[model samples]
Target: MKGVVIIPTYNERENIIPRSGGRRNASQYGIIDAVHKNLPQADVLIVDDASPDGTADVVKQKMKRDPKLHLIEREGKLGLGTAYIRGFGWALEHGYDYAFEMDADFSHDPADLPRFIAEIQKGADLVIGSRYMPGGGVVDWPAKRMILSHYANIYARFGTAAPIKDMTAGFKCYRTEVFKHIRMQEIETDGYGFQIEIDYRVWRAGFRVREIPIIFRDRRMGVSKLNKRIVWQALFLVPRLGLWNLWR
Candidate 1:
């Protein structure tokens, strides 16, 4: 089956392409190359939000040599959820059977792309790369941040009553069928809440959701895009979803 990995980027110019002249950690660059190397058959779709740092320009430059590398340049920073939604629409129109959500940074290893595909091939409608699972873990993250993430997942899980350990995880693979059943335009959340809502909706729609262990490392380059607004939105939205499920 055909698949495409969708990466949403904002000011990730330093991460997607190799630097011309600078003492940079090799791992901090070459994200596009790594994705192609690991999953040669799967096309890489980069949905850039017109980053001021020329992230989209770099993607366009590389697109010259690689036919499998595609890009979608948006007007501005439109948020992560919409970027994936746009990518999903494009993939479906192009006849791709599977779509993947992945980070531009090295936090979500490209090498693990195959494992997610393997699970999808084995009958999983949605495959999540889970960090809170037994064999999964986070590397080089502060203890406080790790603790917050762990507890946040617990809150989201019980609040939404979703059968997922890592509901907020962004790294995932979805069979194109899942998107067809889900009301994509009806989703209104972004960031953390967006991930949880998608997972909850898929489960509620009776799709097989599977989790696979993955080692998540903090981003090697660029600053994190997280903020208090995203966190606060998730805090409130989870219980609201719970209430909706109860009334249904």
Candidate 2:
């Protein structure tokens, strides 16, 4: 099965730098290498939002060497949702059977790429890498942040009634058919809310969703993009989607 991993980036130069330690080390190069190591058939699409830190340059350098590496350089710092949407469109145009959403900061493990594909082959339309599920958890996060994430998931689940344990999960694999059915142009939420919104839409469309336990490690390099505005967006968007679902 042909698959493509869509990694959205914004100033991820440090995260993508090649380090000599090991595969456990976080870097964009490490992510691409790990994905190929685990699933050689899968390709990577780096959707860069005009990173001022020369992140796109790094990807271009690698692209010259790796034929499977693809890139889409946007003009500026577009939101996360738009970045992934652009990548998803590219994946579809290229005829990829499966499309994946992953982080460039290495918070999501590349090793699990194969596992997601395995689940997709088993008839799952959307496979989520869930940190809230059994045998799944986060590492090195502060208690306050953990509490916020945990409750955010709870709130999203209750509000959307999406039957997903990790409503805010960013790491996921989707069968191309899911996107073919959903109206992508209508999705507006960005940041973490983007994850919740997509999951709710897919569930509402009656697709089979599956969750696989995954350990989410905080980014070892660079700063996180989470902000108060993002938090608020998610808080309001969940109930809005819920009400929309009921109305429909």
Highest lDDT among the candidates is held by which one? 1
Candidate 1: regions farther than 4 A off: 21-29
Worst 10 residues of 2 by lDDT: 19-28
Report how far residue 103 has shifted in candidate 2, in Å.
Answer: 0.5
RMSD of 2: 2.0
Residue-level error in angstroms, candidate 2, position 121: 0.6
lDDT (tens digit, per residue) of candidate 2 on 1-248:
88899999998877666555556533435666767777789899999999989999988888888999999999998799999888888988999999999998878888788889889989999999999989999999989889999999999999988899998999999999889898999988898899999999899999999999999998868887888988999999988988997899
RMSD per model, one decimal: 1.6, 2.0
Where in model 2 is the C-alpha error above 4 Å?
A: 19-29
C-alpha lDDT (0 to 100) for residue 21 of candidate 1: 75
Instruction: Report, for every candidate in turn, its global Cα lDDT versus the true structure.
Output: 0.92, 0.89
- Candidate 1 lDDT by residue in tens digits, 1-248: 99999999999998887566767554545898888888999999999999999999999999999999999999999999899899989999999999999999889998899999999989999999999889998999889889888998999999999989999899999999888999999988999899999999999999999999999999978998988889998999999999989899
Q: After superposition, how far is residue 166 of candidate 2 from its true place, in Å?
A: 0.2
